[model samples]
Target: MTRGSLRRIPLRIFSGLLFAALLDSQALAAAPPEVPPPYIAAPAWVLMDHDSGQVLAEHNADKSLPPASLTKLMTAYVLFGKLKSGNLKLDDRIDISQQAWNAKGARLFLRPGSSVRAEDLLKGLIVLSANDAAIALAERVAGSEINFVAEMNAVAHRIGLDHTVFMNATGHDEKGHAATARDLARLAAALIREFPEYYRWFSLKEFSDGRITQYNHNALLWRDLTVDGVKTGQSHSAGFCLIASAHRDGMRLIAVVLGAQDENARVEDGQRLLEHGFRRFETRLLYAADIPAVRPRIWMGDQSTIPLGVGRNLYLTLPRGWHEKLHARVTVRESLNAPVQRGQAVGTIALDLDREPLAEFPLVALKQVGEGNLFQRTIDKIQLWLQ
Candidate 1:
């Protein structure tokens, strides 16, 4: 063949390869099935895996709205903190003030000048959503409701709840008393994490004083065995709200719903979110803080192999049905130099299910790997040069 013909042959082959690559790309793009949106009817909602903090579903989750009685969750959190700190005792008696007795929201029938223990007040607030009980507790804790509200806001800031503002511990529908579903979920998470002992109060289906019995507002507790505690709320402007948590198969999930039409709607939507999470997803431990997940090569270092670990516990929430399809890929430098400190990011551990990356965590050096001596360095350099 002539010189021009020879060049044209290779050009034609290259063009053919390029065209085939484009077609493959288009075909692959088309091959991926579209994922349908979650089934939800709430105006604002969020569902997250408790252990992994994986967001399973969200709809206007950041939109601030009246929290109603769900604001009590933060109140409960603050009270629990005081209890844990020994500043308040559950058995300590509280005198009901006129302000607490005159509170307008839900009531536990607390009478002014009556004495009730702190634990009993907590039961009233959590189980009955009693405004009187909340006010009494607030005043007892901080000397006034106004002062208690300042404490609530301070705790909110410390917990990273940026969108929440508490005007009343009872979650009354004040003009500026508002929070987002995401914030409420975060509050729930904090409650679960910080005061696990106190969280049991949320699971009480029925609580009673000597004269009367009050049932919990959360209906899911009776219907679902997995569901334990959380809170619910309702008001004219707030619509209906519910924060529900369930534990199943060693996985815990939190669902928050806001702006539903009624109690039934709120419960139903919350249940749906919880069901979707538990049925569809699972929690997998990817790595532990001190446990090495990968072994990275070391060059010009004191050690031949370096252990790579996660800085914190790594947990992933992925599709339950896709567990068999899960795969892990650890990417690290073929060889690392000395002076590697503990907790320094050495690489990444990527987790994939169904060929899609679900989560990625930083792989860090588990221990300090120092620079090698002159003799070892010379040997490593010689070996690398030979290769």
Candidate 2:
């Protein structure tokens, strides 16, 4: 069902007993279909809706684990911030440091003192999973890897990645370089939503620098046409990890699979989560932002009524067959007075799954309401006293 099809609960001050009765009546409104989430194969995994920021399914989603190359997602986030702030440029040449040249694991074969464009380094960091490239980019952005890691952690905190910490630029299995599936999913959403312009690079299948060519490690890109991006990581300590995003029809999903046994297991787990999310859940835009939801009477005001609504669109990620059962209740202040300003938090909109509340949204005054003239104010005062 669409947004217009949703049955709205009328504006009314419900008595406690009446409210409880209505909840019972609402519970029998619709017989919701059974759509259970599939079991995720990884130790830590999360499937999230891109538009509504809803978690469809997860296992050990908040458990901290080594990020491996999944740490690169945060690295890319920090770099994207620098690029947006004009602190770094894609075309600017970055000097390769000795530390980068001597780095272990995947390599871009950059000789010490050789200058490479930041754009090229990005390709190496993503497609190639090059440790040296990650270090070089980090050094260029923060002057040293040590300071760059600090920036990464700071960005993690700023973005509300509560379960993430970075001890190095590369997803090298350091003692403290760790992240959770939930945090990685949030990182993936931030990268795609906040920096769509730069996120395009994650879709590239391969990057070749004359002599050597490197293909992206994410296998879903080849197997599924809708699969686009994200990143992959692996180490003895962290296990194989993959963060993947896919767009199907008009919906997009981000899947994080960590601590898988092997490459195939990680890829399979990510694919399964994405498939289940798209098949089982559907995102519906229920309410437009800043629109009048309720008109509650204002006492002693020039205008007798004031509008109320949430400031943003209310998009709900619901089960495939549960749309008609969804309804919302509007609760407003009992003693609303004159001089109410626009954008004020006057009430709340609570969406319900029968008697259980699915989500709650704030209701705000849509327009200003000036105090009434002396006569109206005096009448309201007398009414208040009589009550």
Candidate 3:
């Protein structure tokens, strides 16, 4: 039964949808393909729609492999947290150690027994892919690189990077240190979403310490004006890897290319993947947070009904012009009685594209509804019993 046909506690199946865009099948450019045509030539790769949390294209995305210098992404993530929490400051000077000075793969030319500003170290790690800067930042935060590695792993697991294991902060070639393409994509998304203020640093094409200047290894910054900050990695084992993010026409996409042939190939793979996502798919805003999708009866409450909605702005991504077949079915599992608190999950809203399940989200109370007075409760009870 449809949501509107029922007078009693009802299920909101999409006989009539809450969103008109889902049903409006206007010409939205030619459909790209039923599936993302194979174009990328990497061991593993993924293209994600950042707004909808959807993977538009992926290949062997779950296979764990060394991420190389991309491990520095995690180092910056942890350090940004320290700065955000006021435990550290950009101007604060961090002491460099001999071990960090001896960092093997890449160096920021940091010297032992000398201190550098946190901001400069951060730029070095981001712009130059500096191993020495990664080590120094880790030591400054966690007393040692080993301890910092533990923190990195903990954060990884907590943030749902199940296939990842970080052995160092530098993304160096180390045994037992690997990350899946999908996990790395998620990490980049998290870094951007969590630290937007600091994330602008990734877009800096070049960083200078007055004495020396180095350019960012991520070539897309120069090639594509739409592309912004992200990272790149290379190693003998991992070959080459890059995670790039681009914003265009109010949509953002994250593309991950791992185990590529060379630096140029990785850049090409990233650009191709991002272009594929933007060209092939479209993201739509489904529901704004705290806005009611349905107002269900709240028996024995101060109010007659409570507005139920999502906790955050809801978005859906699908192949171009395919939203015509989308259906959002909401099922209210609870009786939806009084004393409902704001943000309480009352039911689930499920989505189906062409009758195939696509996504689901919790339907939450948008505002509090207190219990009714004695007279109101008595009347509601009688009405409920009769019904």
Q: Choose the strongest candidate by lDDT.
A: 3
What lDDT is reached at residue 68 by model 3?
Answer: 95
Question: Which candidate number would show the highest TM-score if scored against the true structure?
Answer: 3
Q: Distance from true position, residue 34, model 2, in Å?
A: 7.1
- Candidate 3 or 1, higher TM-score: 3
Question: What residue pairs are clashing in model 1?
Answer: none
Model 2 CA lDDT for position 375: 90
Off by over 4 Å in 2: 1-7, 10-35, 295-307, 334-338, 366-387
**Deviation in Å, model 2, residue 387 alpha carbon:** 15
Tell me the tens digit of each residue's lDDT in model 1 across 1-387.
Answer: 211111111000011010000111111211222224467888999997776665678999889899999999988898998899899999999999999999986788888999999999998999989889999999999999999999999999987788989888888788999999888987897788677788989999988988899899999999899999899898888998999999887778899999999889998999889888877777765555666766656777888677876666656555655556656666675456777998888676665556765455566888988899999889989987897
Angstrom error of the Cα, residue 81, model 2: value is: 0.7
Candidate 3: which stretches are off by over 4 Å?
1-33, 333-335, 355-357, 379-387
Poorest lDDT segment (10 consecutive residues) of candidate 1: 11-20
Stretches of model 1 off by over 4 angstroms after superposition: 1-38, 295-306, 333-341, 352-359, 367-387
**Candidate 2 per-residue C-alpha lDDT over 1-387 given as tens digits, one digit per residue, 9 for 90 to 100:** 111133457323111110000121122233344567787778889998877677788889999999898888888889999999999999999999999999899889999999999999998998878999999999998989999999999989988899898899888888877899999998898889888898988998999978788899889989999998989889999999999999887678999999999999998898999989999988665665655776777788887778777755556566886766677877787688989998888777877665566666667887899999999888878877897
The alpha-carbon lDDT assigned to residue 45 of candidate 1 equals: 96
TM-score of 3: 0.88
Residues 54-92 of candidate 3: C-alpha lDDT, one tens digit per residue: 778899999999999889888899899999899879999
